[model samples]
Target: MLQLIIRRLLQAIPVLFLIATATFFLIHLAPGGPFHQERPLSPQVLEALNAHYGLNDPWIVQYGRYLNHLLHGELGPSYGHPGHTVNELIAQSLPVSIELGLWAWVFSLIVGIPLGVWAAEKQHRWFDRVCSTVSTLGLCLPTFVLGPLLMLGLAVGLGIGNVCGWGSWEDRLLPVLTLGLVHAAYVLRLTRGGMLEVLNQDFIRTARAKGLSGWTVLFKHALRGGLLSVVAFAGPQLSALVTGSFVVETIFHIPGLGRHFVQAAFNRDYTLILGTTLLYGALIIVMNLMADLMQAWLNPRLRVSML
Candidate 1:
């Protein structure tokens, strides 16, 4: 396991470098400078700003400087917002995103897994059909649409939670539900399919013939194998959770890193954009590694294959 983890980590290095390199060049190619505006600044003023921030340097030189700063764990200043560094902004905002993501993760698993199992157990019945329909609806609704509808139904009409903003527990309710439920639909579908496949196997019939309790047969014999699909899906799902939901965060006015990342892109805050992109890329790699490890532990055959 340790060797497998080390190997994965080693492989992630080049991927991170490529992400950083591509983001650096592409962001620079976009029209408009970080300091550019409808009203032009005096050339002297612009030159001074460029020189002070090293933006006047050649692209290769700038890339070199970026790498130097990045190596020291320094994400440089935010161009759109004067006097704030990328590091400071992320430190302030990332916690809210993580908090939101964690609750959503828990909510997804709790709601999706059991809902899926229930649907599969009652396959071909009304309950199964209803679950299938609901899952389809959930999958079809994008966060942008679902977010507003949730804001309207629960926040505006019922006044159950805050309409927008993030601080207390109440403010978190709508955002978590909106993001969690949508992702849960995917999990529900995967879990249902996996459980259904497992349940149809010959061993399931043998377990029944052995007169094992229905609950034991389902939970003990079937559930572990049934979760393979969910385990596989977890890597990307977890990365999305930890990174925060951009649409949900925006709709709710949550001050998460996701909102900042979007703002950086539009505002052309070069350092901020690159910082967030690289951070997300790294998170994705780490999450995938963790998922692979977990899957290997669950299935010994996977461990052998890794070896």
Candidate 2:
């Protein structure tokens, strides 16, 4: 297992570099540069600015220099926001994004797993039907649509929290709920389906034959095994929610890496955009690796194969 983990980590190096290179070139390929604006700048000042940032160099040379700096942990300066490095901006904004992501994942698990279990337990009953209906609706709604609707329902219509602001935790209520609710629905469906399948498996039947009480059979034998699938699914889903929260954050006006990423993209801040992308890619890759490890831990057969 340790060797497998080390191998995965070693492989991630090139993936990160590839992501960085792709981000660097894609940003440059856009019609104008970070310096380009609707209002023109003086040619002399532009030339000086270009020279200062090493934009005067050929594209390949500039990219090579950028990669070299990256190797040294210098992610470059903020293009539009002077007096700030890309790392500094990420440090400032990442907390909010991380907080949102944490809450979203928790909310997803709390709501989805239980609801799925309950639905599965009560299959063909009203509770199961209701959960199915709710999950369907959540799956259907886009976060952009859901965010405003939630704001309207909770903030405007119900007047529970502020509609827009980053002043307090209350401001996060609707956004977090909005971002998490849909993911919860997905998790619920997956957990219920997985649990139900486990319940019907041969081992579950054997446990029943051994006269184990229903609860013990369900919890000790079924739930743990069933949870393996859910845990694996949750990792990727959480990563998606974390990265995709940019839209939800923008709609809700939350101060997070997501919002900052969008802002950097709009401003053509190459370093900021590439740095953020690299960070996101690294995070997702790490989470996925962790999930794989967890799966092996849960199912010893996988662990044995790895060994």
Candidate 3:
């Protein structure tokens, strides 16, 4: 396991490098500079600014310089927000996003897994149909639409929670439900499919024939194999959650990395854009690696194959 983890970490290096390289060149190729404004700066001032920030350098030179700084753990300064480094901005906002993501993730798991299990157990029943319909609606409704609708019903119409803003627990309710419900729908489908497949297997029949209690056959004998799909989906989902949803965060007025990323793109804050992109890329790789490890641990055959 240790060797496998080390190997995966070693493999992430080039993946991250490729992501950085692509993001760097693509952002640079886009129209407008970080300093571009409605009233253009005088050529003299623009030249001074360009030289100061090394924007005057060749693209290749800038790439090399950026990589060197990255190696030294320096993300450079944000152009749009004066007096802030990309690193500092990320440090301040990432925690908020992570906290929000964790809540949403937990909510999805707690709500989704049980519903899926019950649906699979009661296939072709009224309860199963209801769960199916709810999951379908959850999947079909995009976050952009679901977020406001939830705000309207729960916050505006019902007066159950605040319309927006972060801090209070009430502020968290809408955002978490909005973000979590969609993923919960996905989890429900995956779990139901996995459990249904597992329950139909010959091993399940044999377990029942051996006089095992229905609950024991379902929980002890079936659950481990049935949950494999959920385990596989968890890694990337968790990474995406922790990164924050751009629309969800923006709608709720939550200060998160996603909102900052959107702002960085609009302002052409090259360093901030690059910093956030790299952070996201790294998180994805790490999370996926962890998921693979978890999957291998859950399945002995997979572990042997990995070795």
Q: State model 1's lDDT.
A: 0.89
- Candidate 1 — which residues are off by over 4 angstroms? none
lDDT of 3 by residue, 1-307 (tens): 8898899899999998999899999999999999898999999998898898999899999999999999999999888888999999999999999988999999898888999988998998998899999999999999999999999999999888787888899999999999999999999988888899999999999999999998999898888888899989988899999998999998898999889888899989999999999998899999988888888877888988898
lDDT accuracy of residue 289 in candidate 3: 88
Number of clashes in model 3?
0
- Superposed on all Cα atoms, model 3 deviates from the true structure by an RMSD in Å of 1.2
- For model 3, the superposed segments whose C-alpha errors exceed 4 Å read none
- Computed on alpha carbons, the lDDT of every model, listed in order, comes to 0.89, 0.86, 0.91
Model 3: lDDT of residue 207: 97
- Alpha-carbon RMSD of each model: 1.4, 1.7, 1.2
lDDT (10s digit) by residue, model 2, range 39-83? 988899889888989888999999999999899998899897878
Q: Give per-model TM-scores.
A: 0.96, 0.94, 0.97
List candidate 2 stretches off by more than 4 Å.
none
In order of listing, the candidates' clash counts read 0, 0, 0
